[model samples]
Target: MKIFIIGITGRVGSLLARSLQDRGDTVSGLVRRPDQQSALQDAGIVAAVGDLTALTPEGLAELTGDVDALVFTAGAGGGTAEQTTAIDFGGVVTAIAAADLRGIRRFGLVSAFPEAWRERHLGAGFEHYMDMKKHADQALTHSDLDWIILRPAVLLDEAGTGRIALGPAELHGDVPRQDVADTMAELLHEPQITRQILELNHGGTPVAEAVQAAVRR
Candidate 1:
């Protein structure tokens, strides 16, 4: 399987690239800076550099040609509402349009847990971030493609516990970045996981088993 990953230099993206590559999949990553090339290269992933927010029709045509699946993990971290919308929401729209043009229907997204979007009623001051993520997730929901949205909780840098828990919007909790990456890689190979938005967290169990349980749900 050949995979095209956006934001491949990101924490989760880097891990996903390596995980896929190790499992014998050919991986290509979309990077924003030439300096990020080495990181992708180090992970044995081919790098294509461009700004997701600025992708033109022709640019998308050139980049997505021959790719099998696209995983969008790009984001504008800790930015103002406008900036967040530009990179997160607008970026997703751009990628979806580009993918459609190239007829690449398989897509995966790394989304935030819905709780992050809650306002004063649930939580406060994260409305902007939550709205940005919500908009992006909703856009993907209506896209003409096979897609799965994985919304994980507060991402931790701790070494992957290799455990994962998955449920509908009903489930909530934090998950390690590494496990999130692993789950994304696994979902890429499973067509049945399409058109679903799954919330993920640490299951205190093995990663593979947790994923299998999610699949069974």
Candidate 2:
């Protein structure tokens, strides 16, 4: 499959790009910095330098012309509420519009566990981030395209365990960045897992089995 990955320089996005390429899939990555182009090239992915903040139809047509699926792994990182909304919320809106125009239906997003914002109350520092993610998820849910939203609890850098626990948005536990990447890679090819919000965490169950169960639902 030809896959277009946004924010491919990010921790999870980089891992996913490499994993997908290793599996013999054609991978295309979008990045902001020209210096980061080598990273995606090293992973055997075609790199396109562009800013998500200014994602346009012409730009998207050029970047995503022949892609089969799109993964939104972009974020504003640590910044003010306005900045977060600009990149997180606004960037997704642009991507969605581009996908619609290009006739690409499969979409995936990296979201935060909602519990962090609703129950734990991580404070205003992260409040905008959470709201932006939630709004993006809601918008995707209402779109006609097939979509999957993976909300992983505070992502960790540990090696993947090849196992994951999947549930609704309320399920809570930490998951490795590698595991999230693996799950996204698998979903890129699985059509049955559409229009679902999956929460991922490290656990005793195999990741494939967990995803299969989610697909069954």
Candidate 2 lDDT, tens digit per residue, 1-217? 9989887889999899888987899989788887788866775778888878877866775777678898999898888888799878888888888898888888999988877536676788688788899998888888898888989887899999988888774467678999999988887778898888888877777877777877764
Candidate 1: where are CA atoms >4 Å away? 117-125
TM-score for all models, in order of appearance: 0.91, 0.93
Candidate that would win on lDDT: 2
Model 1 per-residue lDDT tens digits across residues 1-217: 8899887888898888888887899999788898787766876778988887788856865876688898999888776667788888888888888888888889999999977434336333267778888999999999888888999987888788877777675456567899999988988888767788888888876766655666644
What residue runs in model 2 are displaced by over 4 Å at the alpha carbon? 117-121
Clashing pairs in 2: none
RMSD of each: 2.4, 1.6
Query: How accurate locally, in lDDT, is each candidate?
Result: 0.81, 0.83
How far residue 119's Cα lies from its native spot in candidate 2, in Å, is: 5.8
| Best-performing candidate as measured by TM-score | 2
lDDT of 2 at 112: 85
**Worst ten in a row by lDDT for model 2:** 114-123
